[model samples]
Target: MSTTTPGARIEVRGLTKRFGGFTAVDDLSFDVEPGRITGFLGPNGAGKTTTLRMVLGLVRATAGDATIGGVRYVDLPDPLRTVGAALEATNFHPGRSGRDHLRVLADAASVPTRRVDELLELTGIPAAARKRAGQYSMGMRQRLGLAAALLGDPHVLVLDEPTNGLDPEGIRWLRGFLRRLSAEGKTILVSSHLLREVEQTVDDVVIIANGRLVKAGTMADIKGSPGAVVRTSDRAALAGALRVADVTSIPGEDDTLIADTTDLRLVGDVALRAGLPVYGLEPKRADLEALFFQLTEGTNRNETAATAAPPEGDAVTAQEGANP
Candidate 1:
């Protein structure tokens, strides 16, 4: 095998799972790039959790394998030290304080005790550290779970729906935090159904539907196929001006002036100086979320692909959608 793998990557080859014919996940193949935040995404019951479970060895794969940093997650020495993971916020003990919860995990991972406090502050949960976890809100629990994941300072993160119930502020924080971690060369693999949020967070995305591979690529790949979309603040002038060029002005969100442009930058600049304040101008391409839903649609596609492949190899199927 030439290893046509994920390009010097973290590889998942032919992963499959079943709950006595339920086939939660099947023959999903994909790779997570090193030092990037990769979104593992799908609709409800898309096997996101089941895939994470297989990676954690919590549920054995009926076939295929997932390797982190070139080795199986379980086979890594001091698994916690090699990988940090948070599969579910509900996994935490409700009675434990945020600080104590992290402390226990730190002890288990043999991480320094001071590290717990550092993370409590790092995650903006220092005040909540003393409060009982059970009393914490969904956002608080999610933060605590993140703190626990960081206790080991692992190189790679295997997170499942990390922002599941977080508020917008919390979601924004997670995005920035994950971005910072990736900047530090940490590899993050997070599975989420929040496609728009994932579109903002992930450098690359691996989309699956009904337990199979659909599409996997950098954000650019998803949007590369999207043609030019011109935007300006003065939609009326730009729209009127664009009539001469025959580019249609469609209503786009974000106070935009949309048109199909012959020259993206050229027309964008002309429109702005023409008193149509161009806030931004570029191709309105299909982003990860759009590409995800675009590729993961058809109800039978997932089943057809799953049944076509062996239970032990990698597979990817795509469903996509457009915002407009």
Candidate 2:
């Protein structure tokens, strides 16, 4: 059942989900290309999970469609072997040992038992394999959930907040692991509210707000719009000089000034002309967290938005699709 080919692309077109009067997802559209890790990011109530559930076919969309390899998730001949997903960490039976929990999923998917051990070791939880899931910490549960998701050796991975409980070391390990998976040509979509974490882990990003698409692009493309940070003892003098030179400047941290352009020399020259000594100047890139907040700021005031609901149907169980 190993269907691991060069990863397949994921497409969402005009995807929407309405619960009663509230629209949890609104005409959202994006693409997750093969051989890269795409971050699906939004604030807590920004419909990130709802969108993922629609992609997995766990929740019916009110409008539009989500496809994997150009086919709906339900239409896949062998879903587990084609797309592996871990949406939550607490989806296992508390009474079951970690290994036994994976064993059950392996049996359901008709995966070989040896593969279970392989995944256990792959996720770095072999030492906890004998412990009941109830005794495991949040990070350990995350590892177990990931191991279960990989039991079928799928090509595409859709993980929602996989790093929530990881310590710094665990987070670093997960980052390297995802990068390696992408290098192997797997299409990986990871949903996270942690901007710094996502910035380091993903090559592309699809950000949402008020259940609607806010932005989507490669990280480089998004952050390439450059700026510069300049520091000087005479901050007020530099500001006047920059204005005289037709360059705009804004106040920055530590009483420094932030200029919209990336050219540091122009700023330095401007300061020199004003007889202000240049203390420090450095190139600054757009901050992903700032952009995320900027885009999603007013979403909370919109009445059309709603918090993501737990997925419906057997496609996602508490013990199976716990996080998407």
Top candidate (lDDT): 2
State the C-alpha lDDT per candidate. Answer: 0.73, 0.84
Q: How close is candidate 2 to the true structure, as a TM-score?
A: 0.83
lDDT for position 171 in model 2: 97
User: Residue 255's C-alpha lDDT in candidate 2?
Assistant: 69
The residue-level lDDT of candidate 2 at 305 comes to 46
- lDDT of residue 173 for candidate 2: 96
Report how far off residue 258 is in candidate 2 (Å): 6.8
Query: Per-prediction RMSD in angstroms?
Result: 9.5, 4.5
Q: What tens-digit string does per-residue lDDT give for candidate 2 at 190-217?
A: 9988899898999999998878898999
Cα-based RMSD of candidate 2:
4.5
Candidate 1 per-residue lDDT, tens place, 1-324, comes to 111112124688999887655677889888887678998878776888778767766667788998876777556666666667787787677888888888887786577899998899989999888998999888888888887877767677778888977999889999998888887777789888888898788899888888888788887676664445665656777878777666666667767765755468667666755666665677765666556667877674333444333344322221110000
After superposing candidate 2, which stretches have Cα over 4 Å from the reference?
A: 1-4, 231-276, 299-324
